[model samples]
Target: MPTMKLGYLKVCVWLACVAIASVILYTVVMLSRRPLSLQTSRTAVFTGGHLRLWQPMDLHGIPLWDLLMLYMTQLDNPILKNATAQFNLTLPGTCGENFHAASQGLKNISSYPSHFQAFVLSMHFRDYSLLVGPADDEACPDGTQLLVAVKSQLVNFDRRQAIRETWGQKGLVRGVTVQTLFLLGKQGPGDGYPDLQALLQLERQKKRDLLLWDFQDTFYNRSLKDILFLRWLQGHCPSVEFVFLGDDDVFLRVDALVAYTGSLDAATQRGLFTGHVFQDTAPVHDSQHKYYVPESFYQGTYPPYVGGGGVLCSRAVATQLYKASCHLPLFPFNNIYLGICLRELGLVPQNHPGFRTFSAEAEGQEDLCAYKELILMDHRTPQDIIRLWRGLHDPALAC
Candidate 1:
């Protein structure tokens, strides 16, 4: 009987040993397949415009479940051969700051063959104002005092209450201002409302007059419709030094943008338009999409590249663009139309290194975090913006 009991105990000990071994093996496999951490920066650069920073992750050997799932589902996964490509990137920063130097170089490009102003100098520059769509509370620390023309859009009684209850109460963040704009007679295409009228009303009551064209509508309308509105806005806002057209989804690091503008002289800055410029000596032209603009529609050649989401145009450039818009038939595409207008006006589309029309997800910018340490535009959800603001609080995670 004693021998029988000893044998059973022996078997129990063996089972326990096997269970421990299995766990060890599983852990090893997971560790081996973990994502790699890309090189990092000591600090983040804040570019001009609504550039929203994100929550910083340690990024070291993080689990790749998301990546793996997407990879398996793809018939032609670009990621399978080079898994975690984004995680292996080398961003620009202190150690050589290669990316930063390259980006800064775009601003320094000289107008080699007698500056462009020499051509458009004859055209009178137009004064135009900007229309910032909506300001999600996440993007603004203090309401934009500069948008005096549209003060009501920023101030809201009900929203003020929500901000305190949702944000201030958590101790996660402080005052945040987000603006929402919409077409007349329509609320918005999204699930939520930001009380755009409240903002506009507040602006009106406060006697702020900075808004260029007050009519409400989505910018995604017909190209001709957008041009008409642009014309009205330029005509009305005579004090507009330059026009910055951007969406509420983005946060322009205003101070950074203003500082950069200060760095350039009036002459150098005039006739200057900057944003992400697509270049394809031979780009595929699709006419059906609203983005399609034919060369025949315009008097001159079709411009090589332009993106619509966020564009910066100087007063001189604005006048030339307006004049050219009339001669050049409207193209359904928002960016291409601007490109054609600029080209016909004999003005060039200067690429700004800081411009980011799309996030790393859409544009395939692998070293996005590092290159975007200082960004003019970054696409992020309002909730995402909240978290990003949180991560910045930790001293170790600022970069």
Candidate 2:
């Protein structure tokens, strides 16, 4: 009887050993499948496994997921392969100092921008819910050819009004339907903003053109706003023929815009993303500058990106861009971030002379004739926008 008991104990020990080995094997295979540490391909080449930063294992954050998706894309597309290969070089401080700590469940990342820190925290806790927006398909009624999304703020009521009274008027334009929406983010008293909530609510009720989200409406959070808007577009206006994204302060020649877009060939229209293109630009390191980028934040030159002040993209491109954005981290500069996503998708931005983001030569001094040919121009005040719109549309005036 004692010998039988000993044999049973030996069998149990063997079975336990097998279970332990199986668990170990499974873990190793999973880890090897995707890189656990979110190191760049360049860093991986140099360290050869020495600097293992603690990237989140769940692949929930945009940065980590983007790295994985880029890696997968590199395997299939040679363009991504070359781009990834060229991206091989470790510059200091791309990831913040507390990256490892944050990965290990600590939230002491004060060195980064407040918006960036908020984005990081949002990875674990934030739904990015829509606070106010179009409630039904009527927002994009039948034959909607162009949807204009203008980024605006609570304090910019005058700009929104100017746009509405001018180029942003809804309904038909040049035989095609055009719709408009003003994108806004929440601002509260805690943020030093006035109590404009009631006024904004009334504005929404009267105009029915505001799309508000539950995020801070700060300069740095512009990228977040873009992402949220893209998500909303995918859900709401996915079938729209084209999209024009710009700021509320810009003057857009709606008639000229319709004419230009209508003239595009089918193929060009399918992938259209036209504006003032910035090519081979480097990130700014000046801390005092509004466009400052820390050396540790990003290391490469900017990809060809259309200016954010005004960009026009086709329905197909808009859809693809939304998909690409899912696999990329948000850059502090909203336009630059879109450029990075374009690089990931191997799409190049098209430069058009009509979209003059940085106003044309002597823009303030230019007569109506100079402005007549322009499609979009930035840095215009409410008065300027109104004056330009009226002057350009005058029936008695000939350019």
Candidate 3:
């Protein structure tokens, strides 16, 4: 009887072990398909109706419950996994809509200087060390200046020393003090140098404010949607002159662009969404093509927004556009969507004569040339940008 009991007990133990193993394996499988986890908070906060989602309808009329359920159901279903790891999305909206979104509630215009000119310099700062060798040859011209706001992820604390030593010294160069709006955002707040305030406060003034961006946010893929915080400029701070909207690597002919646009209608100077334009077919979601618009996010066609690289829109126009975009839904691609919105609102993107959207790859070719010839912008490497900036004004090296 004792032996029979022992045999039955062993069988039961074996079965129990198998059941536990199966449960473990099942959990592992479920975890592997975590596209929309319970911790999904990738949403746009409607802080005063700034459109963050690039859709035709506003957060107003769209069946809120249905959309929520759809999103939640997708999150719970572990079998269906569709997640994108990118931080930029091209939403469907015209330029006019984008302008309106930026221009709403622009209060107390009289408080700011009536001649309140703006230079929207779009900058991207991936590397600060790159700024070392590129000396100031084509400096900020007379009557106009630049404000450099940089977003970088370089982890070294010592890097700020170099940045401080270079930019902090107010006496480095004379005649034109380049007003720097330097903002360096990394993976974390503590990631950058703690003593960076010296460089942060060039000419005894700190320009850049708090900027923390999480790359994992689903809505993070859309750049235009993310920049909705720009609405803070309205009615709060109005002493802004010439806001530049370009990336870090972009070598800008600031002197020339300023000289030329300074003479034009300062209130209306904008970009041409400069690139190859295809009319009427509408933007589709072809991953292979340059003009692909994703199907899941954007349903219909896209209006023209300027190429994201280098766009220049004045504060007045920006405010006007923002006002117009108040009731509209979010547009994904800021450049193209802004273009489409502007077209609808009876505004046009004027092409710059010096702008070059593409570059020809060849041996011994300089990437950018912003000399007296006045090249507006160029997409080049840090090394190339340094070289181009240095060589372009050399007087001898004429391209």
Number of the top-ranking candidate, with lDDT as the measure: 2
Selected candidate, larger lDDT, 1 vs 2: 2
Local lDDT at 342 for model 1: 67
TM agreement with the true structure for every prediction: 0.43, 0.74, 0.47
Descending-TM-score candidate ranking = 2, 3, 1
Instruction: Report the C-alpha lDDT of model 2 over 1-399, residue by residue, as the tens digit.
Output: 999999999999999999988866654433333332333434342255542223322332323333433344333332233444332322112211122112433223456576556554443222477888866576787778899999999889999999999889999899989999999998979889888978998998998888998877888777777777877887776458889988888998888888998898999999898898989788787867778665544555677888838899888888888777654545667788787777767789999999885544454465888777789888888888888778777898786
**In model 1, what is the error at residue 342, expressed in angstroms?**
0.2
Candidate 3's residue-wise lDDT over 1-399, tens digit each?
999999999999999999988866664443332222111323422324452222322222222222332332223333322321121212222322222111222222223222220101111111111121112231222332333333233332233233333332221123333333222333334533344444433422332222323221121223332243234334323444445554444555555544654566644444322322333435555656544443433343444455525566565665666654442333434555456456545576655556654463563564434334643444545554555555665677645
lDDT of model 3, residue 227: 44
Worst lDDT run of 10 residues, candidate 1, spans 35-44
Model 2 CA deviation exceeding 4 Å by range: 1-110, 113-126, 358-365
Sequence-dependent TM-score of model 3 = 0.47
State which candidate, 2 or 3, has the greater lDDT: 2
Off by over 4 Å in 3: 1-178, 182-226, 235-237, 266-281, 287-292, 360-364, 367-374
Q: Residues 357-396, candidate 1: write the lDDT tens digits.
A: 5453432223334533543545644443344444433466
Q: Please state every model's RMSD to the true fold in angstroms.
A: 26.4, 10.7, 23.1
lDDT of 1 at 317: 75
Regions more than 4 Å wrong, model 1: 1-226, 235-237, 281-301, 357-372, 389-397
